[model samples]
Target: MPTTHLTPTTVITGFLGSGKTTLLNALLRHPALEDTAVLVNEFGDVGIDHLLVDELDDEAIVLLNAGCLCCTIRNDLVGALSDLRTRRARGEIPPFRRVVIETTGLADPAPILHTLLSHEALTDDFRVDGIVTTVDGLHGERQLDQNIESVKQAAVADRIVLTKTDLAGDTTTLRERLRAINTTASVLEAVSGDIEPAKLLDTGLFNLHDKPPEVTEWLRAVDQDGWSPDNGHHHRHDDGIASFYLEASQPLAIHRFVTWIERLLETEGERVLRLKGVLDVEGSDAPIVVHGVQHVFHPLTQLSRWPDESRRSQIVLIGRELDEHAVRSSFDAAVVG
Candidate 1:
């Protein structure tokens, strides 16, 4: 009578030549992604070896040797997504549990994300798992400075993958630049598109069946030195775009917190590239996790216990041209007022 499964979707984005397709190609071959449906900007860009993949129909849908489905977003992403659902419904396609949308290097991810958030049909059937942004280690710093699009890509990432590390020739500077832009996202090192798929996907709520390894990784990001609200180092940088951490030792009043977030998003949604937190909500022994990209908020997750020893409310806000002092003050005002 009703759908028992909700598809988890991940958006793989990066600037031109960031190795997005290379990463996707590697992911498709992994056994972990066998049930994944991949939507790419162009079929030729991925360059799936003809011997390994077989075309399913004239519509350019192909089934990979590993049992994954690959298709191109011809024009309308909404139409393509709807088609996938319809085909899955009628038994015309594989039962894909996950969907990965790989955007072109030149693309801005916000509109693509907005589609997922505002589209009623897609929202009802799927959930925003997380965003995985690939960064070109060799040229990322220059790109970040020259291209505002590149900056936006790095700002909104849930996981930042550093590609071409072998050729980058000491990426400490690039890595630091990325971290300065986004502290909450885990930056993974990758050489030639090789990485554990499990680390990239399944970043949502914990599941006994499929425990995500990034839970600990995310916790570690928050527990880093000098990120606490009272610390002078609460904000990571002053480069127009920066990340700041807010911690409340006391449990948050759920209603007040939600109202505060909604009000803030309504006004500053465009500036808030990313927001994530592990909250200590009043009257709840469990920890509540909240994630937001721009104006869209994911469904909150309530974990049974603290992932680690620190049980205080921890929130990481990453934004562009944001006023950290005012934000910190507002956070305090919202929590109490």
Candidate 2:
């Protein structure tokens, strides 16, 4: 069950003044996020900044800080992840079931996601479980307008935590802007970065034991059999990013669909921000779930059975300036054969 049971690694990122730190601190304290290794820029928090005693074995990775284990990213995320795995296997450090990485405010999340998905040392043992972006509800709209990085962060998010919403009066415009960028992402409000850890976990297909209903909703556009926005938002995307689903009722040849995905990623990976779906493969009774970011993808999750009676396959793509007709025609060609 190694393939099915890989450790979930969620990247938490947002722009300056976006409440990312507040959210990270909140999430790290929760019992739900326990047994996790948190990688941060600096051990800035009081209880977590203490140095480990050499008698503990090595000073490279620290543990028992706060409730969960801790490691300093310090600018080397790949090194941190690789080191954690090796140390965990050797019993040099406390075992952690999952990982949570907090990116710098100005950093782009794609590189961390790419490393999680494609890095040789970590790919097999870890999977890109989710991307949670904390947005400053009061000023999120301004940040999105002024910062391309903020736009991309929100565009590719799985769960958008709108922090300080209680104080930000009338957030209708901000929500609409977010909806336009990523219609599929679930938008949750957090007052002073107060949000449940359970809402953010399992954004991808992992640790989904007996949660069929939730997983089914995760696969976008349940009622539609054709192209549509996952959320009920209908607006032209002036920012050049769009999210749409391609659906088919009949089972698809897994090989063909996968081949198309590979070529798509190879050719236009940078433009493709996120890809997710639940598929009814030709030979399989159970549904196969797909999740990816940029050029890399998670090992497909083959469920025990269809989440619901809806065996239809729907592939959701969120990207910039995607050629909808060409993509759909190509999908049709794959299905036709």
Candidate 3:
């Protein structure tokens, strides 16, 4: 039998001390993240958050007492990924179907994404499925205002996990800030790095087993041509952050769609933040789903058919200081011309 599916990789990122390890530990304890290989910044470099992480080998490949396998990056990401693939293929390591990468708090996600999606050796077997960013509910506002990295993390997330909610603080303010920053990304609250692993991973257009897609859940927070900055500010956090949706009821021309995206990335890649859309193409029955993190674009995935009865194209954009009018106008021109 042929290889049925490419392994999906999800990047778990957040500001410093945002409970990424805690979340990873909680996810490991459960069966959901089992058989999932994790590439962390370091192993045994810091104390484990929730469970005891025992070193299983000298190569810095450790195992959680709960059976999750993890390895530390030795300043070579491409080498690590290639080595992991080789080990799994040769039956030396567990055949993990999914991989999770935890980036350092101060790290920008765009470069890592560029390597994963654009690298020649990695693209054939691994595909980036989603990015899960964690925000400190108590200090998220200050972080957003002070740190550009924090803002970028939230801007490009597929799911924004709000951690430290049980601590003493008001999360209402943080939630509003995140919404203004990334209206399309799902914001899930975690009590103590604990969340439903299934809900947090494989959040792209399709699952690993190639089952019917979850289109509604993927686009839940976004509305059709809804919530513009010009329509009057509903939240205080909307100062420079904007969230909006664009939809085309009819199928769009393929060339126009590609050109529109290319142009957007070329001119305003830094401000583009996170973009995701499932488009109904003119001649193809399948829907083309595209995702981008800033300037880096993930390989487009075409689904077999529409997940639901509706066949309209919907796109959501989250950006910092983004011009809502220009984006909409350009999209209109693309579809019309």
Candidate 4:
């Protein structure tokens, strides 16, 4: 199945008191997120509560709450999504183009990603847009140093939204720390929860209207050339989690590439918080993009055409205590094969 046209889902996660709700509340009021569906652990979570919820459908779900679809997540997220789909088909709720799930403050986030990307029933209709993490400028540094979950949340994000900059002076050190945790992620500040929704969305490869996936933007950090096997500079966070990348100028044999990915995931999948890249498979005319969260990798997405003239295979990997040389050597073996 093609990735295009699937309702992109964004997971918003952060530590307690990190302003996930504050940012979400401001985003809910924004017109850009008006057509979006928001899922939270409980309605009691007041992330979007500031908005006026107009209508309520029976069965304890808030439909189009805050001028958008808002629902409380039960024990299983799958059931909630299924119910929403059913209601949409029955015209019970307004049609939505995207979805945002707000995770609890202490979440690891890998399990949620696996569910969204690999769940059999949900994959056909929903695709993961990206993970947006909120970090409190005042407490982000302390959280990262003291809490492993907070570090993980920041480590795997596609975008890190730093809140309370207005109150916290000189977040430069905090920003640097975040970049150290995940160099590939875009670090943005949401002072008083003011941010452009566009900066946070569209972080995934797929797009709406069945359009071509934005392969380039999905891996834009590759353009920065951040990682190297010999930089002698390592960015290490809690549990030795770090960001790195491997690239090949020439096309790689599909079999070898697949084998490397299998071995890598089989051994280091849990450590691999996120892995995404564009591969120039030897026998293919267009590039194939691969995205994975932990052990679950999405189906290979071969684009209609390359996003740009750059045909090099670029892979960005975020994991715990990853050995750069070993990964480079293993990748070289695959490419040389």
Q: Rate the local accuracy (lDDT) of all candidates.
A: 0.65, 0.63, 0.64, 0.65
What residue runs in model 3 are displaced by over 4 Å at the alpha carbon? 1-4, 42-75, 205-337
Q: Write down the RMSD of candidate 1 (Cα, Å).
A: 21.1
Which ten residues in a row are the worst by lDDT in model 1? Answer: 63-72
The Cα error of candidate 4 at residue 278, in Å, is: 47
Comparing 2 and 4 on lDDT, the stronger one: 4
TM-score for every candidate vs. truth?
0.53, 0.52, 0.53, 0.54
Cα lDDT tens digits, model 3, 1-337, are: 2324778888888865566765775786777766777776522223222111221222334322211111113125666778889998998886788887776555555445555655577878888888889987655776688667687778768889998777637788789888877777889989766789888977763221221123332222222323222332121222564556788898999888888888898888777655666778888887776655455554566755565588878776767788989999999987755
Give the per-residue lDDT of model 4 (tens digit) for 144-226: 88677787778778889988787678999999988877777889989756899999998865222232123233233322434
Worst 10 residues of 4 by lDDT: 65-74
lDDT of 1 by residue, 1-337 (tens): 2334778888888865576766776777788887777766522122222211221222334322211111113225666678888898888887778887776554555445545654566878877688889998866886688666687678767889998788668999888888877777799987867999988988883221221343334334434432321332232223565566787998889888888888777888767765667788888887886755556565676644564476788777767777879878888998855
Q: Candidates 2 and 4: which is better by TM-score?
A: 4
Please state the error at residue 36 of candidate 1 in Å: 1.3
Candidate 1: misplaced stretches above 4 Å?
1-4, 42-75, 205-337
**How much lDDT does candidate 2 score?**
0.63
Residue 287, candidate 2: alpha-carbon lDDT? 76
lDDT of 2 by residue, 98-190 (tens): 887766455545444444655567777889888888887766886687666787678668888998777678898999888887777789988
